[model samples]
Target: MKETDIKELNERIQKESAFVDMLNLEMHKVIIGQKHMLESMLIGLLSNGHILLEGVPGLAKTLAIKSLARTIEAKYSRIQFTPDLLPADLLGTMVYSQKKEEFQVKKGPIFANFILADEINRSPAKVQSALLEAMQEKQITIGENTYSLDEPFLVMATQNPLEQEGTYPLPEAQVDRFMLKVIINYPTKDEEKHIIRENITGAFPETKAIIKPTDILKARGIVREVYLDEKIENYITDIVFATRYPAENKLKKFDGMISYGGSPRASINLALAAKAFAFIKRRGYVIPEDIRAVAYDVMRHRIGLTYEAEAENITTEDIISEILNTVEVP
Candidate 1:
């Protein structure tokens, strides 16, 4: 891209991305901190990708999703996944209406614009797949008919990192559907102090809706238009290919550590997420920093670790750090 073109695009993006600040302000009215989590949510929202949040309880995962839904003026639904959660429960089921003497399609909570699948791992595989299918297909099938989900539909599924008992963990293939798997941490001491004061005083701030659903739908289009230079594209591919062929990419130490590398979807999501991250930063073109900022969340769940790596207490984060540190930046 020419210098003039980048400047023009930058101006256009700056204008279109103005609402981001307003939306963030409104969200912060209710949410105390977790800037990274909130930013990841915006990236997922703009990229039109579902997210998997891993954290212990009381990290305000549900509250974050709810606050985002409220700020965007979208319908929100929270479905608690349990052992008995059936596929039909997530997706609508057909009911026999005695009065009409016919079957009626009663949509489930999945019909909403934003879904908070709380404790998604607690549910059985059937229930988990049902939600994942809706996430991937963006539609539901009930009876003999198909219903398309509403526009700007997003699923923010949460998993309890501290729990493993009786939880049906998502398979790697199923987990791959999510674009980003963010690991949320406890708030800082200062943030926690505010949280406690707000809770004890019963002074929970309310989030006001700032942007319409159409605004988000429109912003998503602009996010895709963000420039991805050839060098950046190569950089993304190099990062992903390193995961697949570590030894071939100067990452020989990881040759036996990784059981399998990320799939093609990982590459696709990586590019898309970098673009979205650039848009979030109000930049017309993607920079190397944008890709690096989102690389960990985008590739963490996609990469599979070998048993040796796990037994040695190595994590995907460590591998990604090494890859990023070793890979040449554009």
Candidate 2:
């Protein structure tokens, strides 16, 4: 927490962040233009939290994640969730093995370090629940035997907004488990032009591994060591508390804007994400700016809006901005 310690930690974060940046740059070769989405994914990786990405099809959601896995030298698996997908399909089930004379547990794709839950909304609640224990507890139980996933495990799930006809909405409880919900938008005209040129000319960019799984673990430790001052901690607490009781803070703008506020998990994730954001920015100690930078992603899915707010077309982004402006920073 001291200035000298902060300086040392900052140096360390900068070194690790360089590695992360190198990996991202390599991913950019195949992925066109999604700088914001890529940054958020890195933050999620640094914070050791799951990400829920919402975007239209062909936006490179899956490609970005696959490229990230390649850069990190981690095991990657993609599960295509469908309406008929079953929980046993995702979590794997015990099969009778006559040779072994016992039921053997077949591991599912969830065992990988980087799991891409593609079209997550297409699956029903039962199938989605199959990921609950793995996402939250970092372990899975099958056939009375529990297995802990390897370190640096992360779930990067994507959902298509344009097609939701038969999809099951992710419950708030499940949504809360995700650290951030990133919205990937269309690319700029210039970026799209570049994308087309590369494909037409057959000039594919190659990606090389920049960091190993061990490096990710080291970065995570560095993130945990980042300091948070008492004043800044109080500021974070106040912001989260305000969500539960908007009237106490004279937040009339949020009175009809929210039906349910964020949970304790939201507060914890916010703090963790703030630390990661600071670490990514080459800072050892979290500043008010770090919290502000990640507030929307950390709290958007956690907060539920009222019917009137929905009818008025009020979004979580708008409400989060209001909270940021209303809350006095320390």
Each prediction's whole-model lDDT (CA) = 0.93, 0.88
TM-score, one value per model: 0.98, 0.95
> Considering only N, C-alpha and C atoms within 3 Å, which residue pairs clash in candidate 1?
none
Question: What is model 1's C-alpha RMSD?
Answer: 1.1
Question: Mind giving the per-residue lDDT tens digits that candidate 1 earns over 1-330?
Answer: 688887888898899899899988988888899999999999999999999999999999889999999998999999999999899988989999999999998999999989999999999999999999899999888988999999899999999989899999999999999999999999999999999999999988889888899999999998888899899999999999999999999998888999989899998999999999999899999999999999999999999999989999989999999999999998
295-317 per-residue lDDT for model 2 (tens digits): 98899898898899899999888
List where candidate 2 sits over 4 angstroms from the true fold: none
- Lowest-sum lDDT 10-residue window in model 1: 1-10
- Best lDDT among the predictions, by candidate number: 1
